[model samples]
Target: MGRNTRKRSTLANRAIVASAALILGGGGLVAVNFYASAGEGWSSGPRTQRAENAGQQVSTIDCPEVANELPREMPRQARGEVDRELAAIDSQITDAYKKFADQKEQIQRDPQLAENAILNPLKDKRQASIDRITNAIGRGGNKPQGMNNLAPCSLRDDGNDQGDGQNQGDNQDGNQDQGQDGGQDQGGNDQGQDNGGQDQGQDNGGQDGGQDNGGQAGNGPQDDDFVDIQSIEPNVDEPQEGNDASTGSFATDCGVNENGKFNPDNVIVAPGVANGAHHMHDYVGNQANDAFASDDDLANGDTTCQNQGDKSTYYWPVLRLQNGQNENDANADGGGNDQNVGEIQQPSEVTLNFVGNPVSKVTAMPRFLRIITGDAKAFTNGDANANASWSCTGFEDRQLKDKYPICPEGSQVVRSFKFQSCWDGQNIDSANHRTHVAFANEDGECGDGFQAIPQLVQRIVYDVPPGPGFAVDSFPEQLHKPITDHGDFINVFDDNVMDELVDCINNGQKCQ
Candidate 1:
């Protein structure tokens, strides 16, 4: 048979099989629930009816409707530019998915090859597209005045590609193999394929291949080995106590957009982590951000924070206040109104500070030093050596035992964290992405084998209302706990900026 003919036959067979399974497994009614729960407005109408309604046929899973909403939300003069840019991004996302679907068979056959050939390039392209949109938006304005508080357009593909028939076959294979394994001790052949296939599907599904069974596992680091936070002691080794006074400090005010509206895009939950951030983050500095964002990407991208030359990317998960009710709680039961609950009211002000190292003097930080403060996987997994702290602005000495703190009316909520700046001279990153760097001793000294660089201290103060209604939105598995809140930084400063930073710290000169 001809290739196209064979493809059609395969699709037909898969559809027939899917229908059979739905009926046999009593998923016919469940499919309706799936359509409703998918949140994309998919319906269980007849296939012909669905096809007839082009609007209904469009999958809204990973698609961003920002462009469509922008025309209505933005001024007429700015609409054209924003629409054009968003359209290009939408097209890019669609094309990328199509390309992946077209090459699904080859990718599934050899996942690594697919990563090189398809995934990496697609990631770069997507990042570039995001950068373009951000730049376009930046040109229009910095503040969110009169602008609709729209969430940043996201390009996520959660292993739900409907364009590939072969994916269905793979899913069936996975299900069959998993069933046969059935907790039995096998020779590892079947288990290997099942695990390997699932991993590949998850790792490359959004970039290089098609869907797997149902949804992908998750995008965050696997926490299967993580112990409960209560079981682990919090890192009481405070880096700030008795630390040398800062020689210099640089601050950037990242208050809500020009119109005094918080841009959800600013706080991106996970820039370079897989599966995107399980929680929302407030981002500053880098406009083109994702799990695949490179140093070059950040240096070249625009910034929402002040000081354009300071291209250092900074981000942290947003904190929400938990009222007596679960209405706004970010709990695991999905019973709360946590959607955008972390999106606080336009902060009275937002500031990101970079302080000079107290101990080390005259040298530039290595490019792309990925620094994370506090543990993103803390609280739940029994192992909680978390260094994150929460307190009210006026009552800094009073630290809260719970991750989420209810500050008094006169004071603002604050999340303050200090990153490990001492690097292991040679490596830019290590196995855990943090082992190469060590926190300074309580006496403001780097440990042996580690060279101290300029310290990075992130202090975020929010003008949150005093109430039990606030909470940070988190991954369903996180159980709406605040302990999982974390921050990430990627040094994307220009060479001159880096040198100036080095000089400022070394010379013990204060700076803004």
Candidate 2:
């Protein structure tokens, strides 16, 4: 999908039309209301009925994305204030999500409680934050209009959408092939069948405390969330190349956070704000990454990258096992405090490769350029920005966007991202932090004003037990759903190193 299209205005219509609500932003995972999973809408009874009867459980709070509604350009001075206000809205949502989850049963019995207790209070808080945002923008830029529509949020109900838990909102058709076919004739590669007596049944009464507790670690990664990789058909089709394609790749070895650099802050999205992410992140490369690290601090900071010239920062939400256990941050912000409880799993392999665009010569990425791939709020936000790819080591060709991969025994689970490669040739960042860069079209060509750059492809593999027991850390409201997985990167390469990288790609030579 192209940029600047937010699925906000029609919330009321979508809610009424489809029995289930349509959550927008990030990797979109749409819960259903027993509607036609990908097509027909669910019909509902009176709003006063029990939630289960009216629809189903409340999936999440659906607030319009205030950031999406802001003016594209704003005064640099007020940017910080607006960013803080945006972060405040996130905190408010996190707090309200906690309250909603705490009183789910009460809300279910008396549906109005969700409106009175959760949505109403959340709307008030968001309204105040949006007011501050408009004021900040008015100081320099055209104050954004339509912000009033962003404050009022509604509840998205849940069901086994598709009866198999597939999100219907990512693509326009609502009918996604999904690559989930239960056909396997991999000969010796049929490891999923070769495994011993590990039941692959959808419902085996997960660990001691599972969905009964309500999520991966008490908030999600439900039984429907995991799909065996072997059942999926091959769907990865590399884009075609032009005759003069810069068909080369460059690799960077930044050991997967071997030193355990962890935090719950998003320096690019929520700078100077503590716990802005409300979820833990495992970082590699730049060690100076935090909520308050400035450009100067990052430039002078030590890096984990073996190549000292590459001081770039790369981080993403941590993956965790849902088995009853707690990490050190179990009681800390972005951790247990935010309902992200689990044993964090360390990646067994992390590969950072920068590949060239297939249709043109690659250019250097500007210093301090930040790139975020995938959407962290995918569960609540639609898949407009979701770029997550999940699969197993042997079955990389078949990647899943909505369901978690249940890797076969002896095979490792893989989470990968191929970041945006087209740059606008002007700003290193955008107000939305995304419009500055765009992904190449299916033809491998950049959009009109964008230029080709070395595309960063990250692949992180984990040797967790082959089952649905593991899930990634996510914001509490995100329900620890796989669709919410995301990755972040900040380019801090020196000019010399940057030039070499561009040359390597343009000359069709693989370099390290």
- Could you give candidate 2's per-residue lDDT for residues 1-512 as a string of tens digits? 01112211111111112223323222232333221121221112122113222334455666667776677677898889999999999999988877876765566557788888989889999999999999988888787887797898876665322122222222211112232322211111010110111222323322211222222334555544555677676887777788879988889999987787888999999999999999889999999999999999999999988999999999999987655455677667887788776567778899999999878998899999888887786565566667778899999988887777767667999998878888889887877777788888777888799898898999999887765567788877677767678899999998999999989888889999
lDDT tens digits, residues 78-179, model 1?
Answer: 434443444344344434444544554344344454457654565565556555555555566542232232322222222222222111010111110100
**Candidate 1 wrong stretches, greater than 4 Å:** 1-246, 254-274, 320-343, 358-362
Model 2 worst lDDT window (10 residues):
185-194
Residue runs of model 2 more than 4 Å from their true location after superposition = 1-56, 160-216
lDDT of each: 0.41, 0.69
lDDT of 2: 0.69
Task: Give candidate 1's total backbone clashes.
Answer: 31
Compute the lDDT for candidate 1.
Answer: 0.41
Top lDDT prediction, candidate number: 2
- TM-score of each prediction: 0.48, 0.81
